[model samples]
Target: MHTLKRVRLAIFLGILPSLVIYLGIAVLPIAISFYYSFLNWDGFSPAVFVGLDNFIEIVKDIVFWSAVKNNIIMMGASLIFQIPLGLLLALLLNRPLKGIKIFRTIGFFPVVISSVIVSLTWGMLYNTEYGFINGILSAVGLDAWQHNWLGDPNWAMVSLCITYIWQNCGFFMVIFLSALQGVSNEVIEAAEMDGATGLKRVLFVTLPMIRDTLWVTVIFSISNSFRVFDLIYVMTAGGPAHNTEVMTIYMYNNSFTSLRFGYGSAVSIFILAFSLIVIYVANKFTNKDN
Candidate 1:
């Protein structure tokens, strides 16, 4: 019993610093935000109590609804684009080619790059003047299609989706690739021997084997969709009449730009609750699927 107690004490010591940081940075801020959400204050001023007013305003705000719609669009796009493309790339790279390592490295290159740099790179490419996309369109005599990619309301969300897919697909690719490596070669060979090949083998044998990983990736994609702010902020600043605005950016504008820190805190709480509900539903679905 004494030895067991000593082992537990050592384990506690090992995790103590991490626990402290997590509580201080994450838990404390969330607790404070919950308290502040009921008040009315600029960040520096004395907070005045106004229970549920911030949340009430959120429900009535048209722009907030628009931002929620954008978030749903982003989530759908990420699900449709990121994981599927990643799985495709992972499957292709899983083959034993002459330069497989190089291909794998290239496939994962975007994920390692800073999000700011990725946003800037895509922003320049999507620029109206001196942008690669419009230049290509004009050079190919498709001038009618060339418009301000990020400035037009119709295209801003689409542009952001494409940029998001380009920037983050590699992450899921690497994830699926790692999971793919753990799949049994004997099982694969058995499927191959049983007349399974190409897409059939992938759809039937491989995908089922990595189903759990895919579910995890889906959850990651959903959570990442909610947290996406830096890239959109850098590229569009939720502009084009707020067509590309998402919850995080909306919250940021309320807190910092409009100086309604209390309302922003309420928005933050909403984001947290929304994310938790999504994750819960996803978990239930995945459990049922498994």
Candidate 2:
């Protein structure tokens, strides 16, 4: 009885600090944000109760809608490029080849490198005159393909998406690689013995086994894409005509630039709600095959 009590006490003690930290750091802020969302406050003045007005204002906000559209585009881009490319990379590197470790490390290096640096590098790459990408295109007689990537409204979002895919695909590639390693070699050999080879083996055997991992990667990529801000901010600052404005960027502008803290909180809440719903639905699909 004494030992049971001691173990219980120890577990409670170990858990107490984390619970306190979470309450203070995460829970408290979310609660405060919720409270603030209902009031008109500039973040410094006395708050006034406005109930659902802030939320209503959000529906009327055009930039909010635009940001939402941009986020959806980013999510689509992640689905189109990041997941497939990451899987392809994982498949290629999963084989036993000399210097494969080096290749894997090199591939994942961009993911660990600071996003600020990646943004800056991509910004330079998109510069129309002297940027490396445009320079190469010009050298190859594709000079007309070069444009002010970050300055054009039509291409700004796509340009940012390209950078996002470049910076993040490798991380997911590593994840897929790890999951690929988890696939049973015996099953693969059996499939081969049954005359399944090449794309057939990959499609029928390898892919089905790794469906859970693929789902996880897809969901994570989707979530990350929705929350994108840093790259867009550094590269274009929601640019030429607010083309790359994501929800977070829109929220930041409302909060800081416009000093509409209450409205910004409302936007944040909407983003949070929408993101959670999307993630939850994605989780259902991801777990369906499991």
- lDDT scores of the candidates, listed in order: 0.95, 0.90
If scored against the real structure, what TM-score would every candidate get?
A: 0.97, 0.94
Query: Over the stretch 90-209, how does candidate 1's per-residue lDDT look in tens digits?
Result: 998998889899988898898889889999999999989999999999999999999899999999999999989988899999999999999999999999999999999999999999
Give the alpha carbon lDDT tens digit for every residue of 1-290 in model 2. 99999999999999999999999998898888888899898868888999999999889978789899999999989999999999999999999999999999999999999999999998999998889989999999998898888888888888899999999999899999999999999999999999999899999999999888888888898789878888888888897777788999998998999888888888888988988998899898877755
Report, for all candidates in order, the number of backbone clashes: 0, 0
Model 1 lDDT at residue 196? 100
Segments in model 2 whose C-alpha atoms lie over 4 Å from true places: 1-9
Candidate 1 residue-pair clash tally: 0
Q: What RMSD, rounded to one decimal, does every model reach? A: 1.2, 1.8
Clashing pairs in 1: none
Window of ten residues with lowest summed lDDT in model 1:
281-290
